[model samples]
Target: MPPSPTPTGPRIKSPETLIAESGADLEGHGLKRTMGLFQLVCFGVGAIVGTGIFVGLSDTVAEAGPAVIVSFVLAAITCVFTAFSFAELGGAIPVSGSSYSFAYAALGERVAFLVGWCLLLEYGISVSAVAVGWSQYLNELLDSVFGVQLPTALSAGPADGGVINLPAVVVMAMAAALLVRGIRESARATAFMAVLKIGILLAFCAIAFSAFQEGNLTPFLKEGAGGITSGASLAFFSYIGFDAVTTAGEEVKNPRRNIPLAIMICIGLVTLLYCAVAVAAIGALGADAVGDKPAALSLVVDQVTDSTVGGGIVAFGAVVAIASVVLAVMYGQTRILMSMSRDGLIPRVFERVSPKTSTPVRGTLIVASVFAVPAAFSSLDVVVNLTTIGTLATMVVVNIAVVALRRSRPDLKRSFRVPLYPLSPVLGVGFCMYLIWGTGWTTWVQFAVFLVVGALVYAFYGRRNSRLGAAQAQAA
Candidate 1:
């Protein structure tokens, strides 16, 4: 078993030690507790309800037929377990870094480091994937409004025969500019975009339901259990950022109470909306037709009304909503690095928050640049798998942390607790690992490669330089 801090040193920070330092206070570091439950939910919905609905659904629907409804529920069930763990930990910690910080307090430095590294794939590569998705919708918006489209070479990556995805890169830079302004401003922007997005979806479902046909649902299980399971695995990606609700920095008021409430509300709302939208899409357009569409909802709107206005509205919202995804994803990435840096596992440069903006300025810039370059020039199809694996891996760690903390520190007061105790965390781990296994052996190989690289980085710098490690060494 791993030591509380360092295996060989007496200067270890036990669960109790780290817990003593955890709270909602970070004013000395210039982070504020200004966000309320509603704002946190807004951030969660903003982070989650983007590309997955606009882009990922068709692929999922293709696999599950009308049973995509069941698949959405299956994916949400998996996320609910993780959501429970996240809420409990976020309530206890009330700080950013999400799973990474939770792992540190409950599992110690080395496991925490691995969680943060895997999260780079989740947040970093995820932002790139969302950027490319945004580019496609933006082009749709532009074509609708201006009757012009980006050149094929400029619209897609080299995999699609494009020289560069200039729009994708541009959108990421724009999102970074907003995030550098501060979390408050970014949250406000995301809320605004999220509202537009929800409105567009509501409008789509209304029009789509008018065309709803019962026949489309025939053979709902045409693909059977295998297809539904496959679809559920892919659909799981749709719920990626509910954890972002927990990582909303130290700027959340009454975090112990608000964090858990926000987490549940966010997941519940997104889950309901996803199921509603999936049903409407399938009913309005036959399952096969829905799968055929590049922008399924937009096409549904177009099909209902001869005027292109409805489709354009959906397109415009998608373009903006995906921008919010980019912002929120990058925000989570920087904050995780910021936390890791504060622990001396990474460079302190990331730990610096601008007093004026209360933002991790340098860290945000670095994340944006790294993601933007890759999204601009390369096909991210492969890396998207890495993102899925990283998310599942992080969820599994969080589940373990939840259980470990429950047993190790029962004396500590928790504002939220995972229901069914050991069962919740156990199922959380089992379900997520099952999904990860379904991702295939090749993806497992890629995940292993990334972890090996992360291990080397940790061995070289983190183990030697970590404050916790140093403290343990001194005590020894």
Candidate 2:
């Protein structure tokens, strides 16, 4: 066999170097530590409990019938395993890039760039998908309260046979404005919205269960095991943002303690709420009635009570919930880019923190503008599936990073550790891979193409411009 080529520069960045550099950044141009434990947990909840619960239930029910509840549980189990991996890394590294930083410190610079690339797909596209859902619920609210709604051309994207999704664009702009204001302001707003949405969902559960019938749950597994797996794949989208808590590592108070605690608490609270809502929805009305409906939650209340009042409340809540998601997810995306930019993998513009607002103003506006086009034009199904697969891919890297970091750097300070050590992270990888397998072939092709583009970008720009690689060259 031929020998492998050996010309190379810096690869792995030590965890100590990462920690020291982050400290230096914080003392200079880095984000402020404005978030406490409660705000951190609320941010996770705000990001996780949006479009998937409010608008996605109909599709999930269509796939699994009353067994959709099982799908929720399956997906929650997957998240719990991965959340542990994230908790350990988030505490030990405690950087704004989250998994990307973890990968750089353990895997290498090339792996870190790809992780950040996948994250752009996960966070940016998720905001667009949620905004599209927001437009649907907005129409419901308008029709309920004012007896009028936007024309199809104005409310829906081109994929849905409309001129433009005006409401989607509007909501994205709103989130961008809030993010550019400051992280503290954004965290406060998310906390309030998080509390409001939780109350709204709980209210929905009470109303839905009042109309529950045991008969409605008969023949729960509508399509057998395949249905549960497929529905579980879709349900995975609901948990995409729990790790957004980690992206706030630089902007959080006592991050080593708070980040891990917030992740566990957020996942537990969201799981219980998701399962409860799924059961209440299915038990109230048979799967057939709930499937394939726009504004499904509001529609369910409208039918069960023969009153628009209940429907109106749910519709209004959906608006607030989805808007909060755009805000929180957008915040995570900017921070991820900030870390990547500082490493010289991407443009330097993203790392510029506005002293006036203590946030990445340029990055926030650019992200909002770039992603808004898709919110105004793309299909929701394609966007959702793409985002789900991208998120799962990034999480797989995170789990592997946990195990890799453990073997490579035992001396790093960790406020939290995966309870079962390798077992937890190994299971986390397995579950993420299973969900990735359940997605359709088209999404796989799309994701493959995305990775290819990322590799090309790194080959042409990232590898040559990387700060660590340049430093290594100077030392040599």
Candidate 3:
């Protein structure tokens, strides 16, 4: 075997250097660091509290019964572990890419590209999936509020007995438009949607809690440990967007302090909301009824409260919440691609900035195309499984990167550090692995296939085309 050509030196720069290099990128074509802690909190909250609560809640309830509360706690713990790692890295780097950039700096070109690809899977699919869900709620709201019923074929995706999902595609395009206009405009729109969604959730909780009966608490562990584990694995998707806040490292004022605070605060707040909402839902409808529909909260409200008004409000909230999720997830995806393209991992088109808007328009459009097909024809189950696997895999990489960076670059400055050092990162990896295991054989198979494809692409294209490699060769 030809002594496998001694692996070339790492093409990518270290995170510290990347941070210094990013100053130029942040100057003209990027967003201003004008967001205060409060606005940052709202961004985190807005992104984190979306489609998961609106669409995945019933799925969790069905899997774990009232034990969904336990699932939420378990998922939150897992998220905290990864979130701490992200805080440290984001603070130290404070760059555009989230995990993808961090992995590139800590790991290497191939690993970074893989991580970036998986994140593209995570965020792009998430946006499209959420958009599809939003379409359903939008149709429901239209029917309830305006007595206008969209044709079933037009309102649903092709796989769901529909020819096309017009509302979903339209919403995705609208979010893209907002994003291209400016970051501040997108943030303002997200803020409005976030407030409206939270208000509806609180209203549902208030009403549901008032009607809570002891009988609904029966068989709390209905699905046993296996079921709770499954639920936790699924519920983890709900917490996925908390990392989206960290992706705004360069856009937040005092990112070192504000980013970490936003991550921790958002996780805590979203966990509380999820637990409360799950409890209230289970208390009102019981596991059986909640399981009947994937979008359970809205269904439960229609059954328990005044059907007309209650259902309308829940549907309206779902519309706003899912829309916000699409916006945030798409934003995260485009930014990661932008960073990767800049580093020469992906095509240069992804790195091209729109002169008028300064956002990566080509990158955004590419991601939209990739996601649109899946959203237009696939089931939510497929999207959720793919997302979970990609996210868990990325978390494991992030956790390891944290420990590796600690060892390799001990002198590197960081605004935030995982409190227990190796322990926190170790637990983060362990938890992520456990959840990944919980995702079932099919999900594992799919993840494996995706990784294989990613590796092949990197070998054929990324290795040679990488800007990092070109830079290294020039320096040599």
Candidate 4:
């Protein structure tokens, strides 16, 4: 008989190790814990309310009609399950790499490396997609406000009959500069943008609610389960950045107390905003009209109000919100790469911190370069689909890790245990799988290719260079 498998690793980091590696004391790294719960919520909100709302909402409406409201609620339910798991793991680990670090401490080094690689698709590509979408709204706002527009070749993708998206590239470069400066500076800028974006969205809700017509919702559930599932899949993208709250674990004060609360708060607030916005959009213009094009929110506002101001405001919100998303997601990407590099899962260049700014300057540059090229050339649809697949896959791992850790390390203290234990995680996993299944064959092919490439990198380099492997070797 085969020997029983040894449990992989501690589901929670040993308290001694956590204290040694991440105590309150500054270890001369020049890193400071300046982020409060409010700032972290802003980070989550900034990241969550981006191009997904600006562009993807229309697609969801197109798929499920007014029943898209149900889709948003379903998607939020799915996210809440994983968010609880993330809260538990994030509070237990209190690390900077979010799922990548949580998986490493719990699952083992190989899984951790794979999660980090998957995050390349999640954060890196999502930033590019958000940037591309931001460019469109920026152009629209510019045209509406100034009666000037960018050349088609400079404002759109090749698929959209443009040579490059110059505005997207510019937005990314600006964000990269802020990121390289320092986290506090980035947080301040993000907070400002977050406020602007949220205000605009609230304004939209107020105007849309006043114009709401119940007759437009008559054809609710017009699409069936398949359509609701597809709509749920599309709506999932809007919830992407709530995990940003977890990524700030290292910098958060009293992480065990605050991290979970921030995650829950962010998710609740964002869900409320999304549900309100969706209800208003559908009630005013109906679902069929929303999925017509990229700037669907702006279009709906224009159609409902009979003036350009409503559309212009929504467009302006899109520009600010997408800018914030690019900043936050790219920030998360660089930090994750930094953690992986420090663990020797990837190249050491990404681990290098700038003495002047004390940020992962090299990692920021690398991430900016990757995102810049894509935003400058690729289609938004390609980037969005790829990002959605990667994020859903990672969330599935987090759900499984939560359950696996419970069984493996029953003694570990959890400040924020996932409610319903096994059931919640199971539901999280099932929902994530359902969405992954809905991403279609084309996305599956892309995801498979990515996995193959990741496996090769791990086998060739990550296995040998991993910090856990080095630690074990030393012990031997």
Candidate 5:
């Protein structure tokens, strides 16, 4: 048999070199570093506190029973591990593509392409899923004030027995228009939504506590470790937005210092909010009440207060809350595409920025177009599971990327470091894989099928155009 051709010679881009390349203004990529620490924190909070808190909390409570509080902590712990790696890399590279860029710098080109594709899938599905959630709340608000409702045939997707989700598609298009305006504008909008949602949450908490019963906390381990783990696995979705902050590596001021700080601060705040909401919810309404309803929080509030006003307030917040998530997530998606485009891993149109807006105009439009159909026709359940699988896949790649980068470039500047070194990343890998497994065999098959498709795309397109490959060829 002919000896297999020895694979050799493509030099990995060092963090310093990639940093320098990005420092060349994302290679003229238009994202501005105008966002300060406060805005960055707001972005993180905006992204982290959305759909999961508003929609997934009910399912989480059901999964773990009243013991769901433990699920919250476990999910946060896992994200913190991955967040440390994100901080280190975001600070070290300070680029647009989050894990894809990190993987390219650390693991090499082919792997980075895969990571980027998964991220594209992850962020895209997240935006669509959040938009669907938004539609539910929008309809609720309309019904609350005007006593009118959208038809189920037009309001839901295939998974939910609807012909198409009109509101979901419309919401995504609106977000796309907002994003195309400019990055600063997008940040301001997200920050405003962040404050609005947090205030609404605090308001919910104040009311929820009034009806809290100590007996609700009795069967804390109602589902046992398995249940808690399952709940945690699902709850892990809440933390996905934290990494969305890293996609702004080029947009944040003092990214190296601020990225890590913002990550910690946001994670801390989200964790506290989740715990308070979960504990109060289970205590006040019991685990049985928080169902698969899209407007679960609003319903929870209505039960706690006899007045329609409380529910109205929550429904109002849900409108802004899911929008905030969609905004941050869509922003992350565009930036990731822009980054990959800058790297020649995707089409050049995704790399083009509006000179007027200093944002990736073409890329933003593509993101809007890509998810519009799915948002209109697919079930929220299908999109949400796909998003989770993509999230887990991204986290697993990021964990390994951190470990690889640490070994390959010990001298690179990292303003933030993972505390336990190998343990943090190793555990990040293990826990992410475990959560992926717990997502069930069906999700695994779905993920595998997606990756297979991604590999084929990379082979046909990204393989030849890869910037790293070109550089390697020139050097050789």
Candidate 6:
């Protein structure tokens, strides 16, 4: 039986209850624990390695010039700090909700609802951003391989002077279909794609580095401090998926051990690849050529090798990379909603798992459909900035939640702990704030509006129907 709502103040779920219920959910007909450490890392890498690298780099490079390499490093530093906090909480709670579950256990229901809302902006919007990037690469691949390209009407959105971005919508639908099949199948596909994309990126670096010139990197900081900070803000988008690994807590084998380890490993591995690729791209083509090229990497490869074959290979890899991002990130989004729905914060439909597939099919489709519309109409930059702001907001809460959990649940056993404890989390919060500060004023306004809307939604619907409030009412 479900509890009926009653007015109640803020409430936090105990770590013990959160862990126990999560375990039960996994044991019963909920999500299956099929992912191991390898698949887990692959999932993270797949999520983090897309869009920002293969497509958004043009803007990032344009923002920071050759010094975009420095922007990547700065963004990685911020992610590393926050990733530590996530590693600690994820290992302890091991829930499908990721940061939202962490907040519920440490920050109470209202804050948790908002964090979940921020995640909607993060993962949901990111699906559109990644899909938009995938469409560009798809066009690149076709033009290289078959000497034909998707017409602007079909490939670009209204923001890009096209009626609709059909390729973006098509790719989003494809990823959603794969997700509805099952988690095991999705993880396997992501892992294969993860490996293929990494190989392709490395090959791109090898070819590009051959033509690397010292002169190309001479005026690295042409855009100055403002550019680096703004570029870092954009670059932070690249690391969005690392935390998605933690969202798989319920689906991963031995959550305590694998979750933390996978997160740390994913961040370290991706930071290296991003920096190397940025350097190779800038060095080969110079910052001027790199700027605003939708398929910058493929263009770099083409110029370096003076052949479309080299460009074709990199384009193919990007298509695989961005597609995997849509799959993995959408999976994370559905799980977050499922956690919320189970708490009676949203409709129960989101929490229901299919008897046949053991996956939240309805929730997955709902998320994909809602997000695909944005992919069809909005530009890539618009969705990417929205995703970055939303992501940074959730991470700030996650960092604070880690500190609160440490103080409140001193006895809770954690497989991992953020090194330096308070300092690490504080730095995590600071770094996240710094990136958020670098964002354009317009994005901040949008984020403010988003928060206002989220507050209203929670107040009108989430607050009145919250499962925690019902539990408290019963206890009283």
State which candidate has the highest lDDT. 6
lDDT of each: 0.83, 0.89, 0.82, 0.83, 0.83, 0.90
Pairing residues by index, what is the TM-score of model 2? 0.97
Model 5, span 383-406: residue lDDT tens: 666778788888888889888878
lDDT of 6: 0.90
350-392 per-residue lDDT for model 4 (tens digits): 8777777878787898889877998999888777777888999
| Per-residue lDDT over 1-476 for candidate 6, one digit per residue giving the tens place of the 0 to 100 score | 11222345458887777766665443256788999999999999988899989988899988999989999999999999999999999999899999999999889999999999999888998888889899989999999999999899988888898889999999889989999999999999999999999999999999999999989997868999999999999899888889999889899999999999999999999999999999998888899999858799999988888899999999999999999999999999999998998888998888888878989899999998999999998898777787798999999999999899888778889999999989999999999999999988899999999999999999999988987787888877
| Model 3 CA deviation exceeding 4 Å by range | 1-7, 25-30
Stronger candidate by lDDT (2 vs 3): 2
Model 5 residue 418 lDDT?
Answer: 89
Model 4 has a clash total of: 0
Write down the TM-score for model 5: 0.95
Which pairs, if any, clash in model 3? none
What tens digits encode model 1's per-residue C-alpha lDDT throughout 1-476?
Answer: 23554447343345444434433223355676777777788888899988888888888899899999998998899999989999899888777778888898778778889999999988888999888888888878887788899998999888868999999999888988998888788878888887778887888888888889999898989899988887887788788888988777477888889989988998998898899899998998789988886677788778878767888888998987888888888888988887788778988788888878888888899888888887987664556667888999999999999888878778767898999998999999998987887677899998999999999999999988988776666766
Tens digit of per-residue lDDT, candidate 2, span 390-435:
9998889999998888887777788999998889989999999999
Local accuracy of candidate 3 as per-residue lDDT tens digits, 70-182: 98999999999999999898888888788888888788778888998798667888777788888878877887789898897877766787888777788888888788787
Q: In candidate 3, residue 170 scores what lDDT?
A: 84
Give the worst 10-residue stretch by lDDT in candidate 4.
1-10
Better structure of 3 and 6 per lDDT? 6
For candidate 5, list the clashing residue pairs, or say none: none
